[model samples]
Target: MTDPLQDPRFLQDPYPAYARLRDAAPVQRVRTGSDGLHSYLVTGYAEARAAFTDPRLSKDTARFFAGRPSGRELHPAVSQTMLASDPPRHTRLRRLVTKAFTRGSVERLRPYIQEVTDGLLDGWAPGGEADLVEDLAAPLPVTVICQLLGVPEADRAAVRGWSDDLFASGEPARTDAASHALAGYLAWLVAAKRSTPDGSLLHDLVRARDGEDRLTEDELLSLAVLLLVAGHETTTHFIGNAALALLQDPGSLARLLDEPEAFAGALDELLRFDSPVGIATFRYSTEALTLGGTPIPAGVPVLISPGAANRDPVRFAGPDGLDLGRDAGAHLAFGHGIHRCLGAPLARAEGEIALRTLFTRFPRLRLAAPEQEPVRRRTRLMRGLRSLPVTW
Candidate 1:
């Protein structure tokens, strides 16, 4: 009976709801507010981990929705990506992407990430107020992703708007429109790269071929859209979420500020304390299976809550509290199994650079109005603040 999406408290701070779910019903069925879709919400750390790698649960939406009128059609842009496929297909797609998304590839972009971070911070005058989400968190990752994808600066705003709509809730028609628009745009972008390639990941993907295996036109478009949307959105929220966490706990913020070398470990704790992607993408049961002693019927949709699992007290001592020194290396913030985020390295680098640089530039940074609550994003797929107003 408890609907997390309908509850404002849950949207604002889901950790309490996650705690309740983990204790009472680790695997409980709930209907989504937007489309009334029924799904099993897994909250326990162990349960979520098992579900992530479980072969019984499937990511192939086409197979799961077969002969079912799911209202809207599954756009190739949505269905053809590695996020929506099973092994062999997912393996091939991931292989091609991994070649370009390697740690070294992302490491090469560190200077650019730092440059963008510094430029954004430079606009914020010391002892003046600024919206951290707008001036820093949002634009920093967007610029990095746009540059990496070879997206023109003039088109970044439009692309960001489309990306927002794709993850938004409540308006099914509007969401469809945005999805189509992004897919169409990526299709054109892929074609443009064919004639004159840019030395970007999109270009590398366009040219990627493995033993006579090449990405189809639709696959190329879907992959590009995925990279662009997923690559930026995760990091954008991460910076905001991490910054909010630090701002609220001056002790931890001070520790990181005093010990610059501690940012790496502190970043992991921040991710565990509040993940950007609250829930992993949808997965369906291929056959009846048991998760945390609860039986899931065949063909039922399952949603693994990384946000909840990361805060499981059984897995983490004093999980609700954020300890910068906590060993959070095993957190499921970037997900688990074969479908883990490909852009995690890039996101981690961006978070560290953005947080470190922002604090260094404004040592006395604090929330503009500590009494006022920050706005939370409405979508269940992501957990992030809309804006974080701050001043020094």
Candidate 2:
């Protein structure tokens, strides 16, 4: 059967489909595209967790397709980054970048995060409608990431345009164009950073590239693009999805508003309820492996759905319901194993500050168009509303 996942409705509310898939089997093969591309989908929590840490499931796409002839080649900017690499290369790149994304480093930005949140919300006058995605969710993370990377304010719009195009679905040509544009911009940015270091994370990366044999010129450029794009994209969706969830449930919203100090704990449950990243990035089998009693052949692609696994009936009681007090710290929203999201700490900090400040500033915040259905982004990789209209 053709994949039901390609349906836009599935993207908007995939929990039902995920429940069906999880109940049917722990792992099932499905055709992902009309191009005859197929992959194994791991839906159960135990199976999904194992798939994430399995050494046989490789992230090195190039190695996975070594002798095969494919119509498209992933841009060096994406292919060479730590996200798409294997160890010792992944080890080297991740080690250098981890220095800037530590819990302490991200925690230090809490004050700045609140300041940015306040500044954004201050622009939206009471009783006037504003798109939460545009005014708050989208710009907040981009501004923080740009500042952290030392990207100039004048250049942020262009950066955002390129990043959006890169993640946009069903636009191969646009995706390629954005990849090249982003790569070219990063190349220039790195060169400019080298001439005049600014103490930003990008500056430190440039130093690593030039001072030691640690990172190559290509790796440096790729890592910068990865940091800029991945740093904000997931967090942007996290804020939007979390807000939408609360808005849909007035009881939850009222409760959250009353307990302002509980935002941190509440954020984890929000992430688990509707994870920003629906599925983990592609992984291929290095050798034939059996998962949940099903044998997957080597060279076949495998996708682990955290969206599905988080709601597994066996894992959490009342998995579908939003429980702010639930211990959801183990959710695979940041993924697992060596390739886990490097910017997770930063994303969490941003989510907590953004949600708390937003609701606190506009306690009467409510959906501007309650009768209208939310328009979700069509991308297969992410699960988020394209826009969230709100007013106080």
Candidate 3:
């Protein structure tokens, strides 16, 4: 079967196609790349949840490419991160930074996040139109993450540019250039943090490294790159996708306007309705195994679609429709098991603050062109609006 992932129409609204795929079978093989390679796409809610924990499915990028040379160099910046590893390595690397991202840590930033949201909104001209993505969604998370990561004010813009370029799908050369640029910049930042240690998170890691040598130089730099990029990108798009959905939904918009904090309570449903990351990151079958009753061969890539599975009819009644009051905790917007997103609490806090503040301030906020489909970024694994023009 053909993958509709890159098609313009599918990017606009992929649920309909996703529904058809899930209906056919929870697991189906489809050509997922321009090279005509096939990967098993998991769309069933139960199957996806199970696949996340299945030991037979491995997320080890370095191991997968070890003997088979892809005829290209693997950027250590991209390859050495915990995100692409398995077992003891993934666990060890994750433990290093997990303390800083706990719920308590993220909640402490609510006030600062609110202040940032207000500052961004303060710039919007009253009653005039603006792209929410550029003005609000993108900047809010970027600013907060940069602050926590100790990225200097002057360097943040460059850092964010590199992060954005890292996700520019369909452009391999651009992606490679960005990976190298960000890796180099982060190496400098890490060294600087070591020389003049402060209360920042990076300094803490540097201190940890000095004491026990828990991680290597490559791991340190790779970890920083992963955290910096993953920190903002998801929250940025989460806010964007959620805000755009609410603008298109009058009833939801009015409800949020009346009691903005309700947006926080509705986050699970909001994430379910339109996930920011369309699919979970890389995974491949380590041994031939059955997922959702279909056999997947060893070495074949396996993709789990949170976007599709969140709307599986068996898992959620009327899943396509957005129901703020619905119980959506089971949704897989954040992947299940060990590989679940580390920054989830941070993302939720940012999303809630950003959405609540946006609608509360502009009660009459609306899509500038309700008739036109919003322009969407075409990255293979991410789902987000390129711009969301809105007016009050």
Best by lDDT: 1
Model 1, position 111: C-alpha lDDT score: 97
Candidate 2 minimal-lDDT segment of 10 residues? 206-215
What C-alpha lDDT, on a 0 to 100 scale, does residue 110 get in candidate 3?
90
In the range 1-392, model 3's lDDT, one tens digit per residue, is 67685687888888888988999999999998777989999999999999999988899887877887664443788756888888887887887767545678788889999999999999999879999999999999999988887899999899999989888887777878888999999999999998987777777666553236476788889888988988999888889999888887899888877886688898999999999988888899999998898989899999999999999989899998999989999889989899899989999999998888888888889999999989998786888988999988
Alpha carbon lDDT of residue 326, candidate 3? 93
Clash totals, every prediction: 0, 0, 0
Error of 1 at 241 (Å): 0.5
The CA lDDT of each predicted structure is 0.89, 0.87, 0.87
Task: Report the candidate with higher TM-score, 1 versus 3.
Answer: 1
Q: Sort every candidate by lDDT, greatest first.
A: 1, 2, 3
Predicted candidate 3: what Cα RMSD to the true structure? 1.5
Candidate maximizing TM-score:
1
Estimate the lDDT of model 3. 0.87
Using all chains and alpha carbons, the TM-scores for the candidates as numbered come to 0.98, 0.97, 0.97
lDDT for each residue of candidate 1 in 30-85, tens digit (9 for 90 to 100): 88545577889999999999999998999998788789886764367965577999
The superposed Cα distance between candidate 2 and the true structure at residue 369, in angstroms, equals: 1.3
Q: Which TM-score value belongs to model 3?
A: 0.97
Q: Positional deviation of 171 in candidate 3, in angstroms?
A: 0.4
State which candidate, 1 or 3, has the greater lDDT.
1
Give the TM-score (vs. native) of candidate 2.
Answer: 0.97
